[model samples]
Target: MRKLLYLTGLFILYSMQSMAQANDYVQIQAGSYQLGDTASLANPKRTVYIESFWISKFELTNAEFEKFVQATSYKTLAERYHNAMVFEPGLAEFRWLQDSTAYWRFPNGVSRGGIEAKMDHPVTCISYKDVLAYCRWADCRLPSFDEWEVAARAGSEGYYFEGFSKENMSEYANVWHGRDHLKADYSDGYLYTSPVGKFKPSPWGLFDIFGNVFEFCTGKLHGDGDRYVAHARGGSWWCSKNSCSAFNTVYIGSVRPNASFSNLGFRVVKKAFTPGDKDF
Candidate 1:
């Protein structure tokens, strides 16, 4: 009888802890907003409506990914394949290179140290499949393109909310700002990924929505391909005004779902349950 009571008490404690974690999700109200960018021929700007959902205030970090990996003993696509794309500073115009040892733990490759102090840095080198696995483990899902843009907009319109200027770019985001791609000014005090929430939050209290790392979204078919490719948004430290210019929320970037890149990462979202909700 004593053992049964102790077990019941432990179960209750675990349930409460899970509930508290779930409560950390931010509630985003349902609404209609314009999606896509006019500049891109692939994704013309269009108005769309989205249902209410809950999303994490910040991007998934190395620490969060570590927990998922430890709990599930899951091997990311990069780990299974034994290679992932990384940004090589030596390459001037284009910096991306495939390094056999690059993965989430060692984003720069095996030559670099593990993410000990960079636990707060956004987890990169994650493919779409890997993101899906993490979302499943967390009981969440990747937000659709429309849903992601809506949340990123934070109840505002235009390329950025307001007050976002070249002089103040470092205050809001992390992007390339040197004379060339090979050199990072580090005016933002970070050469690569910045710690999540290091910059000011959006109007809705979301962090690193514009820069730090490109966030993966749902898959979609583009061009003549029968297979759907995954999408990412917000750009990263590699983006610059003359180069990627990914800070513009209108931009919709796409890549193969199976490919993992150093500038890529993801966050999760959950359906918002309303009063009298009978199903999920």
Candidate 2:
């Protein structure tokens, strides 16, 4: 009876610790900013107002996701579908291929011998539904498109938060440095995805806001007969300046809510607590 009580106490303590750690967030003050790129006709720039909220400082990591999985026994979309899109380094133009056994646990797919996921790396191969499940479990929600763009810009007005120069990009993000799609320049010391926060943070101290992986947002497409398609921001390691300059603050990508890609992931946000509210 004593042993059972002791184990129950330990479990409660661990649960409390996990809850505290998962709720960590950085405060973003209320502000108005441009939502889209001024250069692109498809998605022209527009003014938007965002309320003050708490956003995660870094992308959701494999270690953090593991806790949720363990707690809820939640299986990601990649696992449920029994396949995931993976990057094929040998291909020149179109490099993404679907592998039957790929999941978040094995990001590179089963053919590559199922490499273990890095704990610090951002969790990938997750669908919008999967992100929703995670947010629900974590007591948070995915950031909206306007909020995401505002945070990525970090009060800067440029193509990138830092600038458009190659040197600035190399210092701030992880993107393809060479012209060839198959070969990365490795100037950033990462060929595929680097661990979250591997590069310098934005002015708001947000990491991996521009690159590392395409982060899903809460926005959906409407008007033009397209609805329920989810929004994604930032670029990935596979993106190049010439081909897909998705690293810019104004770029917004869309995907089906059920579609899960290797380069796609998400962060979370919550309303800022008041002085009298209970701590999250």
Q: 208-261, model 1: which lDDT tens digit per residue?
A: 888899999885636627866788988888887778888866787888888888
Residue ranges of candidate 1 with Cα displaced over 4 Å = 1-23, 221-224, 273-280
What is the lDDT of every predicted structure here? 0.80, 0.78
lDDT of 1 at 202: 78
**How does each model score on TM-score?**
0.87, 0.85
Per-candidate clashes come to 0, 0
Give candidate 1's whole-model lDDT: 0.80
For residues 1-280, what per-residue lDDT tens digits would candidate 2 score against the true structure? 9999998887777676655644466778887876676676545778877889888888888888888999899998889887678886666665578887888878768676342547888888888899999888877888987788788878876666755455578778888887777654676787777898888888778888888999998765543265678778899887877768788777778778887788888888877543233232
Question: Candidate 2 lDDT (Cα, whole model)?
Answer: 0.78
lDDT score of residue 42 within candidate 2: 43
* Candidate with best lDDT: 1
